[model samples]
Target: MKKSSFILMSMLLVFTMFVAGCGKSENNNASGETPKTETETPKESEAPKKDVSLRVFSTFGGTDTAREAFQAALDEFTSKNPNIKVENDTMSANDDGFRTKVNTDMTSGNEPDLLFYFVGADAKGFVDAGKVVPLNDILDSDSTWKSGFSPAALENVRQKDGNIYAVPLTGFYEGLFVNKKIFEDNKLELPTDWDKMKTAVQTLSKKGIIPLAAPFDQSHYVIEHFILSAAGSKGHNSGLADGIDPNWEKGYAAMKELYDLGAFPKDAATIDLGMASNYYGEGKAAMILEGSWAMGNWKDPAVLDNTTVIPFPAMPGGVGTGKDVIGGFGSGFYLSKSTFDNADKKDAAIALLKHMTSPAVIEKIALANGGTPAAAGVEIKGKTQTATEGFAMVANADSVNNPIDTMVAPETFSTLRAGVQAVVTGKKTPADVLKEAKDIEDANKK
Candidate 1:
């Protein structure tokens, strides 16, 4: 009996030992200290994504519709990309010091991850400095995005080296914004030729109405339109790189003729662009020379209802036939090479740029500003008469040239503006202005 009792005790001890060992193994697996099978799931906290932040800069501020549209698109981007944060730094494009600020930041190596600025000669400095990233590879890799841009828009941003540094948003064209109703009310003909323009100016001036809202203080717009009208695209572009071409003399003379005929407001010599726009918007003036982008400022219903755009009338004996336009891809976005070099931020920055310049966003901007869209297949819905006329003028233009202010060096542009003002005010003749411009250009070359 004693032997049997001992055997039972031994068996029970063994069984208890086996069960305890099994429990230890199960605990080890649950504690995650042991290797698991391939079927095991990953924890939610494992391999978390790192958050990224980007700096974006632009010249879209104030109550401008472009600003609002850009903000909306940026908000949407942030919502979609919760892992990425964008810091927007904006300023007024109309600010005289805008270019100075941009250049300072860029030169100081404090550039934003993305930038909105003028293309062509204005962007050439950054591109040459290797500060801007060439977008050819990115655009080529993404066929959808590449196909959305118009060829002409792409060409405008393409550099002489065949590299594209920016993505165009909205292109612009310079023309005369006319009050059709005002002309009809006065029994005046639309200014289709130099003679008709003179007739219209005389009739309007005699009735105490300002025929054209001319602002000499900020006369770049006037100079651009007059030069393109007189010199044509080929003549203007050829002369802009060098000093003032002889063709520019014709442009200066044309502006002087208009000034002598009393086509401008009495205070035109002192007023700025804003004042000139107000003069036209308030129905005090029959016409204003402005770009397509200015359409947003004319929000007065009366002004909107009466306004239509037309090319400037042909200058007498000018090289241009009055069909040449002064405009192209005036502004676009530039990507920073430093931002794109970071392994983590590169993909996100590219994605953000693509999203910002997407077809939907571009269309929204165009509609809000009533400007020409750079993206292809973006139909301007609920078109204004002004926009319709502007588009028609662009489509029918014989050739499009960049504004002189955009093509020339900053000093030369300033000199040209002041010279044109002098000519318009009769303080200097066209020949005198051209000689002074040539001197400045020669000095700049040296």
Candidate 2:
């Protein structure tokens, strides 16, 4: 959406939401509309229910925290509308294969009725192909539903075309998650700055503890935090369409510096994000660079009890304030164009979409995942200490940014990710790797 339009919409929602006291009437339909029961009578017996089946693809699988809550939401919708049967299709999205699968399915004409995916360049393929419907008219048709969303959240997901094709559930933020108990036990100070971080890395590695639990292959968080902290918001957000920023070189250099300090696992190149997370969760590592959605997945009570998130400390000569963060409403639900055009599935799909993105469901999912709720005035109760610290970190941050992957083409990003191992292992200089990535970016633009 245009900047002016986003601002105007934000102002309108803020006024209306304040008038509504940041909440809607209780017992309303999942879509935020009050039930029409006062005027309509039961007619279940008058006609057979038109049965409809929907497939919802999301990342709420394995230890995603929101898995159970999402399934419960599906169950509730099924019970309320017996005619609609929802297949809760889910997958762990900690690896590149998930994106491959999503792209393949979307391109193969096997798109789900409702797909939960990223918002920016990651979505450009199916979006440009017209495989999904822009949700502007749909959201406008239902003021209650649109009103339930925070304007900023919707604004974050709006495409460059000045249209919204996705309805967000919960937003997220990423930072360095520390195991406080481990630090205390080792008589080490928390790595709130570069000096302290280096001390922790050296000391922890000497003690045979993983200083930073990160995988070289699935290094999304590592790449994101390092670049944002080193390059600051402006340089980081500057897409490769122009050229390489020198600060970006500093980011990779910092990663190499960490590698020399034994900051990564011995098998970092082989492990995936899950195993990296496992090392941190099992208290085998002092810290892990991760996102808010990852907080609830750690089952170790000791680790969970002592964990706190901090922005990756700013590096020497870097312009970042040491408080710049990475995150926002990065992902959301999209209604498939085929589903909308299907006369037999249109209403059912829309109803299911509304029910899933409802404030009530968003709240439940946020409570479970500790993500920033997209629904206006919806508060998360029973948030863990880690989540509380995360919120405070974001609230005090100088800037919040989306991850770098969202700004560039998929293949270009893949090249960047593939560069991490080579950069750290001395096989490639940061400049060389970035030049290769820039070449790929240039080709993609053509």
Per-residue lDDT of model 1, residues 163-280, tens digit only: 8888998877789889998999999888988899999898999999999997776788888878777887877776556556777888888888887788999988778787888899
Q: Residue 156 error for model 2, in Å? A: 0.7
Q: Which runs of model 2 end up more than 4 angstroms from their true locations? A: 1-45
* Global CA lDDT computed for model 1: 0.83
lDDT of each: 0.83, 0.91
lDDT by residue (1-446, candidate 2, tens digit) is 89999999999998998768535555355567856556887666676778899999998887788899999999999999998889988888775677988999999999999999999999998999999999999999999999999999999999989999989999999999999988998999888889999999999999999999999988888888888888899988886866898988999999999999999999999999999999999999999999998877799898999999999999997887799999899999999999999998999999989988999999999999999999999976437888988988988999999999899998988888899999999999999999999999898878
- Backbone clash count, each prediction separately: 0, 0
Candidate 1 lands at a TM-score of: 0.88
Query: Residue pairs in steric clash, candidate 1?
Result: none
User: Which segments of model 1 are wrong by more than 4 Å?
Assistant: 1-48, 442-446
The 10-residue segment of model 1 with minimum total lDDT is 238-247
Model 2: weakest 10-residue lDDT segment is 21-30
Candidate 1 local lDDT, residue 194: 89
TM-score of each: 0.88, 0.89
